[model samples]
Target: MLIGEVARRSGVSARMLRHYDSLGLVRPTGRTVGGYREYSAEDMRRILCVEGLRSLGLSLRQIGRALEDPACTPSALVGDLIRWAEDRLEREQELLERLRTVDASAPSGWQGVLRIVELMHGLNSPSAARRQQAVLAPAEDVRVPTELLAGAVLAESDPNVAGALRWALARAGSDAVASVVSGAYSENVDIRRRAVLAIAEMSGDEATAVLADALRDSDPTVRRHAALASGTRGVTAAVPTLVGMVVEGTNDVEAAEVLGRLSLDPECADRIMAALVDELAAHSADSAVRIRLTQALVEMSGTIAQGVLGQLAHDGDRAVALIASASLRPVRVVGLPDDESCDDAGRRHPSQVLRR
Candidate 1:
């Protein structure tokens, strides 16, 4: 077969075929009567071999060595090729993700594109401070991509940087809610905690729904954050968790205050009081737990807590009795009758009774 005929039949361009011949990767092994290049059957097979290797991302030099070196083993060379291709695939995937983020941002020009790219690089910087600055210093006219910010917030560990990232994510608005929620389901506990914290800062039905789901997370840390935020948002679903927090003494003070406010709702007040009273009864043997619960009662507004406190004033544990007795003093004079009245100011303990 002539060189032109081989190129035409094999779909290899003539220019590329000539270059392959020059590289010694394939030689015609014959000359026509007219001095034209004539490819023998074996030459065509060699050309096909080189093309096959090229399709696997092998460099021409590597391909040449692969074909020429009798000592070269296919297992070892193929292994190397696989590794190289995998590395390239990973890098390409990262580049493609960056490109998708940039396109999602909808930059107006190359300058906008460059700015966003720089911000993304900074967000991925090794130093926490640099990542924080990237979030803080975005161009006034350009919007930082929410997906990028959401991912950063989930992985950020530094207290200050995490706060800034959460703030930035909140500014990124509800579009970031789903990304942050996905982080809540991460296997890493720190990421799950960060996700809940970030979701706490976001507003909207979606964010609220995510928080509600987080309230039942297996990680106690995640559940506590969700409860605190959900309590503030008036999510009565957090009542049981908040009550448990009061019993456990972890963020118990804040939990009590939120529960107190939540208790103002007529429908929730009885249930809230019942939960507190039940915890108090359940943990009665632990004096410290009882003391904490007794103190938490000061934040409740309904008559149920007042009645509970009145009964606790004479609790079997002296410390519990003392704390409950002292907690009641500010409510009224020492002789004020129980189940009677100490006036409206004394009816329910002051809202600022406990600070956590």
Candidate 2:
């Protein structure tokens, strides 16, 4: 077909055709005698492959091998990619586990969720963290509606159910898990806890206030989960609330876990340090709080995480002990890029970037 005809049929710009030509991706069979470009059926198939790879979350460079393999099946490709995901999740879980042991302030439910993420990290190929990374990177926009996520959660079952909801929520938002979170909040304490789990798994600031309201819930599990959810989404406002609970509130295991995630904030570094100082001044204080505080310091250091072991070389805490004992420790930081923010900046202009 002629370039103009191909452009019209493909809904791809002529300029993009030239760019693809330059990439030597969809090269012509031979030039016309008049020197105009001509595309064959084979070239069209290659273009279709490019489009398919783009939709499959593969970068053009990364898609080269797959595009070249005519026998490549999406199912097989996805399965291979799943193995890579499995390894990453396993490693991330181990790191999270080490962080948890040292972390005393974190809520039990928060730990439980992290553990779950640890167990099921490879359940989905594109995780919430990975999806957020893709969302924030230089690529075409892919929006999944919240309603779609909610419905999918109900239609699916365990193993796949949780991961699918998380994947959708990462691209969508809390509204995605609205049905599950809403349904759980009204049930028994355990049910409410599961709801909070759903919210945390697929969470952000969208339901921060709603989760915050749960902080005062009669159920400790609900309150604990709210604390953990706020931390995952970086709801700093809940810091003071969590601190109050840790200082004078219940000595619950769940509360402690939330405190651990809570105290992880670098912004609250000074506050946590001062808390430790205050405890040191009172010689009769409980070792339990002190243990959590040390875990908090090590965790905070890990979170800030650049040359942490070197900087904390002199800290006398056992949690800081990880710093002294190092053998190529791997540190992973996951989040959205600066440009592709989900809060409000992700909103698209009406029909912008639409193909005719």
Candidate 3:
């Protein structure tokens, strides 16, 4: 077949076919009297093979090596091709996400688009400081999209940068809640942890609801963060996890403070007190555990906690007795007369009692 006929039948442009011939990938063996290029049957098969390999993302050079080199193995070359394809796919995916974030920002013009792009580049920068500034210092007229902030919050590993991202997301409001919530359920534990922390800083029914759902996360870290945030939001379901934190000594101080605040509710007070008392009984064998529980009681309000403190004041463990006795003493307000105790300060709130 002449080059024209081959190009027509095979759909390979004549110019490309001539280029392929020059590269020796598919040189026709025949020629007409006019000296035009002609292709044999074998040459057509080679052309088809080259196109087939090209479809798999092979470079022209790699295709030549693949077809001409007897020692060339398909396994290694195919593996490299797979890896290159995956890399390309990942880059494309990142580009798509960046474009989506930009579109979501609803930029007013090219300047707005440029600003968003600049912010994205900063957020993805290797320097934590730049990422933080990207979140903290958005352009004057452009508000960083909530989705962009949420994405940064999920992927940020540096504590400072993550905190900044979370702060930005909080300022951006509940619009980012869905995006952050998806990270809360991520299969990656680190992502889930970051998600919960970021969502914890956010306020709104959506954020609170996501936090409540996160309370059941299999990862203890995720559950603890969700519990701390949820408890403060008046989600009584977090009481058990808050108590567990006290038992495990994980952020136990903050947990106890939250528990104290929760106990201010007349209905919840009894339950919170009961859970604490139960933990005290369960951990009686460990004086250290008992002492931590003893201190946690100070956060509780009303006479019930005082009674528990009274009993612990006389307990066998001297350390526990000391902590309990000290807690039982009336906490004098800094500015009030020595005679005026916290009780005389107009029934201080449980959280206030903890501060004292």
Per-model lDDT: 0.86, 0.55, 0.88
Model 1 agreement with the true structure over 147-218: per-residue lDDT tens digits: 888878888889888999899889885587876788888888999899999999998888888899999899
Residue-level lDDT of model 3, residues 105-185, one tens digit each, is 888899999999999899889999988888787476876788888877888899999888887787785577876788988
Candidate 3 TM-score to native: 0.86
Point to the candidate with the largest lDDT: 3
Model 1 alpha-carbon miss at residue 163, Å = 1.4
Best by TM-score: 3
* Ranking 1 against 3 by TM-score, winner: 3
Ranking by TM-score: 3, 1, 2
- How far residue 316's Cα lies from its native spot in candidate 3, in Å, is 2.7
Model 1 scores a C-alpha lDDT of: 0.86
How does candidate 3 score on lDDT? Answer: 0.88
Candidate 2 lDDT over 1-356, as tens digits, reads: 87887788877778888888887777777688899889998888887878776775666675777767788787888886778678878999877754543342232555544433432333233554543332233312323334434433433345345554655555554345555666455755655665665666654455666677777778765766677677556566555555544544443344445545655665665565455445434623554454443433444433333344344444465544443333124322234343443337755444334221
